[model samples]
Target: MRIIDAHHHFWKYTAEEFGWIDDSMSAIRRDFLPADLKSAMDAAGVDGVISVEARSILGETGFLLEHARQNPWVYGVVGKAPLSQGKSAVEEYLAKTLPGADKLVGVRDVLQGSPIEVFSDATFNDGLSALAPHNLVFDLCIYHNQMQATIELVDRHPEQRFVLDHIGKPNIKDNVLEPWATQFRSLAERDNVFCKLSGMVTEADPTNWTAEQLQPYFDTALDAFGPKRLMFGSDWPVCLVGVEYPDWLSTVKTLADGLSESEQADFYGNTVLKAYRIDAD
Candidate 1:
């Protein structure tokens, strides 16, 4: 199927920087570099991956670009920089860091923990403006509650290509999908926006989540964005907190089993290549 894991991460894990890895996520507390992910991808038959930034630091882009340079399977990178500082900072950061980072196809700033007001901030929207000129996709990583504000943000940037990370991070833990589903569909109405079918396991009961519990959310994403705008993502090391790499892949396959061959292709790889503008060659 030419599968590309559209979202995953590579990190030299440390408590200080990866503080989000609370005691519950102890399994992924150690280093997870290209070699570790290579093994997992090989076992799961994943052809390549887009390494998303785990830390919202300037150095993270370079670190991921280095991994992509060293490993052919690391197809592209979703980097991080000072996006909230406004357009000038984004321009300067890209000018300095993007010199040789051809593998860096996108940028992301952690929106999951930010105040909802950040979504409507003019400076942040300006920063998002800076990415369009460079052809960099801006990954939206907000929680489900922030969807309305994000819809506004996406509305502000029609020229920008935005990938909605984790399907707006719906609240699967409590089986709540009201406002999230409504807001999610509204966001998908924008043609420039795309969605990644990753990070669902962690959003659910990590230890006890069943594929059945995740079905509706996936169905919602499929119905909203369809195969063309929806792509598969492992969410990797974070996914390990809930399900093993291979099991997650299996679950996704089962959930998406109704897709025709071409639809499967779009969901698995084609959407990623189109969204990231990754060169298939």
Candidate 2:
């Protein structure tokens, strides 16, 4: 199928750096580098990966860029930089960091914990403006409640390309839909925006989630974005918190079973390539 995993993570974990990996996440508290991921990708028939940043730190971006440099299987990277510093600082950081590393295709901020209004800030919008000139995409990693603000932010910058990480991070754990579905439909109305069919496993009843449990959210995304704008992402290592790579792959595939072969191709790889502008070898 020529699968391209649109989202996953690689990290040389340390307690000081990855304090977010608390006691319950011990399974993923250790290091997970390209070597570990390559085996999983191979097992799942994934041809390439766009490694997304797990930490909101400049060093994490450098780490992924170096990994991409060393690993042929890593097709691209979604990096992290402090967008609160506004446009010039972001430009300077990109100038310093992205010169030799061509695999850095996008930038992200872990907006899940932030207030919704943060997306509307002038400084943040200025930082977002710096991306288009560099040909970098932005990965929006906000919770579902922030969709209105996300929509506003995306509306303000039609020139910038964005992929909404985790399908707006719907509240699957509680089976809540309403406002999320409505907000998602609103966000999908933006032509420049794309959505990832990833991160759902962890958001569900992680220990006992059924494909049926995830189907509604998947259906919502598919309906809103259609096959062309929806891409598959494993959200690996972190996905280990809920399901293994093969199982998650199977679940997503099953949900997408109704799609035509070409539509399946778009979900599996083409959408990722088009959205991120990934140059796979």
Candidate 3:
């Protein structure tokens, strides 16, 4: 099977732009360029990755696109744009950036910290409306609290494809799963939405987390989306705060051991290719 990491990131890290990388994440304070990720990928036997956006800037998209142009292992990019600014803004951004960006497969805005109302914002939905014609998947990066709002947004655009990043970022630290589990399964009812099995370790108790603690959440995702709609993602440098790349990949492998060979193939790679419309050839 082709082992594509459905999500990861590349960044020329800065304290100013990447303020989210606070002191706790000191391990990743410097920079994580394509070279850094190449080493990790080689170690894990990952075939390629879909490089996701870390900063919400147009330049971030260009940065990823340039890296993709240089690195054949970068299968695709999920970059950011000013989508909340309205439809015209989204269309204009796409017009300027999409011409030569063959690796650009999707767009993401960090909606986890934003107000819930933003999901229902008419202008924002208009921006989403603009993507379907171009066939861009929108990577939804939100907290568990935002799942209902996310469902509402998904209902608005059945034609647009969405890949949920980090499995709604459930509260694994406390082992709390109710509304998150319920809402997650609810969201999965829409075939247009897909989920990434990434970033869970970071959301867990970083110092004392165990595979046992993560298995329930993994089970929830599997039960919700099934293997075909769920994809493997390393979340890379960000995941460094929680666990190493190879360890996380191994954990996911063990968690997915119950799947048949065909199911494993879809979970590890094929699902991402279809969700992002990436050409494996």
Candidate 4:
């Protein structure tokens, strides 16, 4: 399979810049750059990676774009924009940064921490509208509770391409499936929206999470989005908090063992290529 790890990150770790890397995440407190990721991708037979922004800053996007320029294996970037800056500012930033448009495939905000109502804000919606004209995707990085807002956002901007990062970030650690599964299914009804099969491990009981533990959530996504709309992503350095790269890849592979060769292709790589407009070459 032509494997594309659709959601990993590359960062020069500094506590002040990435305050999310608290003492609990001490294992990933060090720097993680292209060289470090390339080694892991090579070992796991991953062909390339779509670098997602870890920090919700424009500088982080610039860093990924520079990394993409330097590293061929960094296939594309889902970078951050100042969404709170309102529409005109976002449009200006996109015009400036997207001149290198081939590598800058999408934009994201760390919505997991923001108020759900942010999705409904006039400024945010206006900023989102700007992306459709540029043919850029938006990566929705929200928690499960925010799905209603996400659904409303996706519905309002039917022309915009949105990918739900982390499958709406289910609370697998608590084994709470109710509202998440239902809301996820509702969100999947929007044809313009896609979902990433990423970030599950950290949502689970990190240290002792089994493949079996992840299967239900995986199955829910598969059933809801089907292989064509669902793409695989490692959620990398964050994934390392719960499971190693190879093991996580293996677990996804095993869960997908029953898929046909073509279905496997979509999950492993093809879906991202289409969704992000990644230049596979």
Candidate 5:
């Protein structure tokens, strides 16, 4: 299987960006680079990877791009640029590095707790609209609370492609489903929407999550998106809190085991490639 781990993060120090993984999950309290990821990817048969954004000094996609430039195995990057800055900013980025630019695949804003109703904002729309010429995807990192607005944004930009990160950071830890599943199914119903089967283990009971516990949401996403719309992602270093890279990879395998090889291919790599316009070969 030629796997493409679609969502992973990198940072220089634990004390820097990932204080979220402190005393409770001390195992991976250090920086994890491409070198660290390579062995795990090799073990899991991940031929290439897409480096996702790790919150930093802001407008830090340059750091990610530089890293991507350094690594052949890093197929591309879903880096960040503030879309709410208006289309002029977006145009600058497009003009500066639109096509084949350091494997830059998309833009993302971690909208978990931001006070902005970006979906309703003209500037935000202007920002999203700006991405049109660049032909890149958008990585939507939101909480369950943000789904309605996120969905509205998606509806507003039907032509743009998006991958819903961490399955909208559902409350798997509390075992609550209800509105989350319903909303997820609804979002998946959109033609331009895709979901990343990543970060659920951490969302679940950190120390005690079974494959069965996470299966329903995974199954529902698969049902809604079909194999071709769902992409496999490790969520990497963050996944270390509950599971390591290899373990996370196996969890994906367990969820995907029922599908035949081709369907598995879509979930593992093809869907992400299609979503971001990356070449598989």
Candidate 6:
């Protein structure tokens, strides 16, 4: 499929860090480096990927960016430097992060928690505005209920290109899709925004999800973002909580099987190339 898996994550934790992994989510209890991900994505037929930020605080983004430099197949990164850190700090970091242009593709925040008002933080706005001249994209990882604030954030910064992580995180576990659907549909109308077709397996009943169970959410997102803007992401290490790389890739293929070759191209490869501004030699 010549795929570009746009949203995967990596982390290095000795003990103190991954403590957040709670023994409850056992699969991601250790360090997952670029080498491990490359092997997995290769087996799944995904040619490229962008390493996303893990919860290692702002310092981790720089760490990942340096790592991406050595792992060319990683393609790029959506590292975090909370836009709320104010503009000048962001400007200086941007200046220091020069050669990073090839790898630093976007920014993200932990929005699943403080839904509607997270972006309202003046610091966040300042952090967001820092990307203005850099032309880097913003990846919003919000919860289902917080989707509206995402849309509002987009409204305020029409210049920024926002990609909604995991279809605004629809709640498939509870089978609640209405208000989520309503709000998601409204936000999708923002042409500046896009969506990733990943994380559904984790969102579904982990033990019992068939293709039919995931169809509506995928269809809704495709219908909303259209083929041109939607991209495929693995959400990797986080996805290990429910499905492995191969399992999730098979699920995505099953869902995409019904589409035409062109549609497949858009979802699996084209959109990523466009959105991440990937340039591979």
Local distance difference test values of all predictions, in order: 0.93, 0.90, 0.92, 0.89, 0.82, 0.81
lDDT of 6 by residue, 1-281 (tens): 57888888888766676665777577788788888998898788888887888773778788888888788787888877646678888888777774535688888776777746567777778778888678788888888878777777889888888888888888888777888888998998888788898888778876677778888888888888887888888889888887889888888888777778998888888888787677764
Q: Is candidate 2 or candidate 6 better by lDDT?
A: 2
Displacement of residue 68 (Cα, Å) in model 6 is 1.6
Model 1 stretches astray by more than 4 angstroms:
none
Mind giving the per-residue lDDT tens digits that candidate 2 earns over 26-130? 899888988899999888888999999997888889889889889988899999977899999998998898878889999999888797678888998898899
**Could you tell me how far off, in angstroms, the CA of residue 211 lies in candidate 3 after the best superposition?**
0.4
Compared with the true structure, model 3 gives a TM-score of 0.98
Q: Single out the weakest 10-residue window by summed lDDT for candidate 4.
A: 93-102
lDDT of 4 by residue, 118-212 (tens): 88898888877888888889999999988888888889888899999999999999888989999999999988888999999888877878888
The deviation in Å at residue 269 for candidate 4 is 0.7
For all predicted structures, in order, the TM-scores are: 0.98, 0.97, 0.98, 0.98, 0.93, 0.94
Off by over 4 Å in 6: none
* Full ranking by lDDT: 1, 3, 2, 4, 5, 6
Residues 197-236 of candidate 5 have per-residue lDDT tens digits of 8989878977999998888878877887898989999998
The better-scoring model by TM-score among 1 and 5 is 1
Can you write out model 3's per-residue Cα lDDT over 1-281, one digit (the tens) per residue? 88999989888877899999888889999889888898998899899899999888878899989999999999999998788788899999899999988889999988998998899998889888888898899999999989999999999999999999999999999999989999999999999999999999889977789998999999999999998899999999999988899989999998888999999999999999989988888
All models, RMSD in angstroms: 0.8, 1.0, 0.8, 1.0, 1.8, 1.7
Q: Taking the tens digit of each residue's C-alpha lDDT, what string does model 1 give over 154-216? A: 889999999999998899999999999999999999999999999999999999899999999
- Supply the TM-score for candidate 6: 0.94
Alpha carbon deviation, residue 218, candidate 6 (Å): 0.7
Q: Residue pairs in steric clash, candidate 1?
A: none
Pairs of residues clashing in candidate 2: none
In model 4, the runs with Cα more than 4 Å from the true position are none
- What 10-residue stretch in candidate 6 is worst by lDDT? 93-102
